[model samples]
Target: MAGLIDKAKNYVAEKVANMPMPVATVTDVDLKGVGIEGINYGAKVSVDNPYTHSIPICEISYTLKSADRVIATGTIPDPGSLVGKDKTILDVPVKVPHSVLVSLARDIGSDWDIDYELHIGLTIDLPVVGNFTIPLSTKGEIKLPTLSDLWSKNPPQSSV
Candidate 1:
């Protein structure tokens, strides 16, 4: 009886290991907006769901690091659900306080951008699998907007 149970457990493990799961990737990160208290940056994530039914996303947690220091970390609870049998695109917004930006001035002043590593965890409830998290990370530089660029968007009218 014990031998039969061991064989069944092994079979189940093998099947779970061979199952097709969701795939996720961090595609891009860029500046989203500027605010008085902080600057908002957006990260784009692309996920492909293999299941035939929609899965509810538990949460999306993220951390942004620069110069080996974590500048921002937060959790987005119950963002949304992933599309069934299709691809879903998620946009995560991160806000870095002006105080934090001042601390990273060295890197930003050197190249007008900050070198960063963005770490993200996407948690989903999968059928029979319970809760699963897809860990995604990407390293890149985030460029700060220049005065000229900002002015161009809302160019001031010449005094009449």
Candidate 2:
């Protein structure tokens, strides 16, 4: 009897281990907009669902780091759900305050860009398995908007 129960447990474990799971990746990160609070950047995430049913996304948490310092971090709760048996693209936004930019002046001054690493946690509710978290990370450089670029967008009015 003991041997039979042990074999059953082993079979269940093997089945779970071989189950198909969702896959995710960070496609790109770019400047989204500028506001009074500071600069807003968006990270594009692509997730592929293997199941034939839509999965509910519980939350998306992110951390933005520059020059080995954590510049920004936040979480988006109940973002939405992923498409069934298809790829879903999500835009995760991170805001860096003006003061934080000033603190990173040394790194930004060198090449007029910020070298960053973005870490994201995508949580999804899978059928029967409950919640599963897919960890993603990417590193790249983001160019800062120069004075000329800003001026070009909103030219200064000539004083009469």
On TM-score, the candidate that comes out on top is: 1
**Model 1: per-residue lDDT, tens digit, 45-97?**
99999989899999999999999999999999999999999999999999999
Q: Lowest summed lDDT over 10 consecutive residues: which window, candidate 1?
A: 151-160
User: What are the models' TM-scores?
Assistant: 0.92, 0.90
Q: In candidate 2, which residue pairs get closer than 3 Å at backbone N, Cα or C atoms, i.e. clash?
A: none
lDDT of the candidates, in the order given: 0.87, 0.88
Which segments of candidate 2 are over 4 A away from where they belong? 151-160
What clash count goes with each model? 0, 0
| Segments of candidate 1 deviating more than 4 angstroms | 154-160
Clashes of 2: 0
